[model samples]
Target: MSGHDLPRLGSLAWEPALDRPDLLAAPVLAALTAWAEQDERVRTQVAVAPIDPDHADTATLNAVHGLPTEASANCVVVAGRRGDDERVAAVVVRATTRADVNTRVRRLLDVRKASFLAHERAVAESGMEHGGITPLGVPAGWRVLADARVAEPGTLALIGSGVRRSKLLLPGDLLAAAPGVEVVEDLATAIDA
Candidate 1:
């Protein structure tokens, strides 16, 4: 949506993300600026909203903002080993679905097993807060895998801005088209929620 057309959810007062670097963590701001340099649409399409860090989780964030579950995506860090080398990646899936970590991610990483990265390692390595890791600005070598469902037309998903105090709203197609993202089918399976 355009800047003026930004959706008004329950309690969030949306502002252009570029207008509030303070709301974004260092890495997130850097990534956003870089992306905007390459894609002008990024400047208008992305937005941010300040929030209580306590409401950072998807369920709580949606509840407080009157956002539907489908309006957000969750980013998870996964790591697996192949021989002596370790591979790391971030997976973005709709909040209504869970990543097929064991079947899909493991196969994609070419590892015997894949598991969630340690909380300490994820936060430290990503330069982001514990509950606010987005697929944007992950380490260069780390792959970003987004489930196809998240990138369908007309989807705008709320994502962390590398901090719990704010969030970024971005179109799913833009996320799929991001420089390092790989759009994969069946990467996640729907859950009861």
Candidate 2:
């Protein structure tokens, strides 16, 4: 479905991402623009919304914007090291789940240990705000691992547009097919109630 088909939210105006470069990071804008050019679905389906920086966290964003928690996704940067070599990846999962960094991610990365990247490093390296690092514009060579649940067709993931002052909304399937994204089974485990 296209953005025009979706209901409008209060105050948060939805617009084509390609039309608002100021709301996105350089790399993210480049990638999304390229994808929109190459795929008609992307051009019509992707949307962006300006948000209050203070309410950028998933729960707060959802509550204030009337978006559902299940429709949100979180992208976390993880680092793994073996000897002198270090590998970093962006792990994307539903807001209802947490990345399985200790076991699955560590094993997949083939590193001795896997841990969340330092907050400062993640923000600086990604060229994004501390709470707004996303898989779309992460530094090159960093893997993007998305949990299977992130690809469900009807679900729209409200993800960072590389900044805390705005957010991107797109179908999960589109995110799964984004450049460098790898949809992995059981990449995240469900959170306890």
Candidate 3:
């Protein structure tokens, strides 16, 4: 995922005010950048400034070419359980592809149940501020899983930067390379072609 080899998704027309370097100066950004530096497979190809109002779902699709065919996909991390202790895990699926958490992840994690963590707890425990939650800065003990559809060719996702004001465009394969990530099909529903 070196900046050199990254194929242009499309004309990157947007001009971000890189002047405000603070946009990516947070701890979460540091962690994500560190991971990207360590692995060429799971690196951040580009960091895009999220719209002030946050049009992430649509903006992410538009930012990349040959993507966003009818429906969009994203990777989300949910805090769950591991041996009676709370933990976090990621699930990648289309905006149209819902993760059947109650059924799929529960069985996968061997937990009696699974649910989206409370917003407050998610922000605090993940060490990432709210709206900026990305699997990048997730706690070490947590597990990650991506729906196989995430690996589909040309798939793009809107991943958080540990801050809501910004996001990064990540190829499905690169996302799969996130630390401790477990790629699986357990969390997705099919979309008609």
- Local distance difference test scores for all models: 0.89, 0.86, 0.59
The alpha-carbon deviation from the true structure for residue 146 of candidate 3, after best TM-score superposition, in angstroms, is 1.2
Say which prediction, candidate 1 or candidate 2, comes out ahead on TM-score: 1
* Candidate 3 lDDT: 0.59
lDDT of 3 by residue, 66-133 (tens): 34532345546666666767756766566667777888877877777788877787677777666566
TM-score of 2: 0.93
Model 1, span 75-172: residue lDDT tens:
99999999999999999999999999999999999999999999999999999999999998898879999999989868887889999999888778
Best by lDDT: 1
lDDT score of model 1?
Answer: 0.89
RMSD of each: 1.4, 1.8, 4.3
TM-scores, all models, native as reference: 0.95, 0.93, 0.73
TM-score of predicted structure 3: 0.73
Lowest summed lDDT across 10 adjacent residues in model 1 is found at 1-10
Candidates 2 and 3: which is better by TM-score? 2
Q: Candidate 1 — which residues are off by over 4 angstroms?
A: 1-8
User: What clash count does candidate 3 reach?
Assistant: 2
Give the alpha carbon lDDT tens digit for every residue of 91-174 in model 2: 999999999999999988999999999999998888888887888878887999999999887777778999899988888888
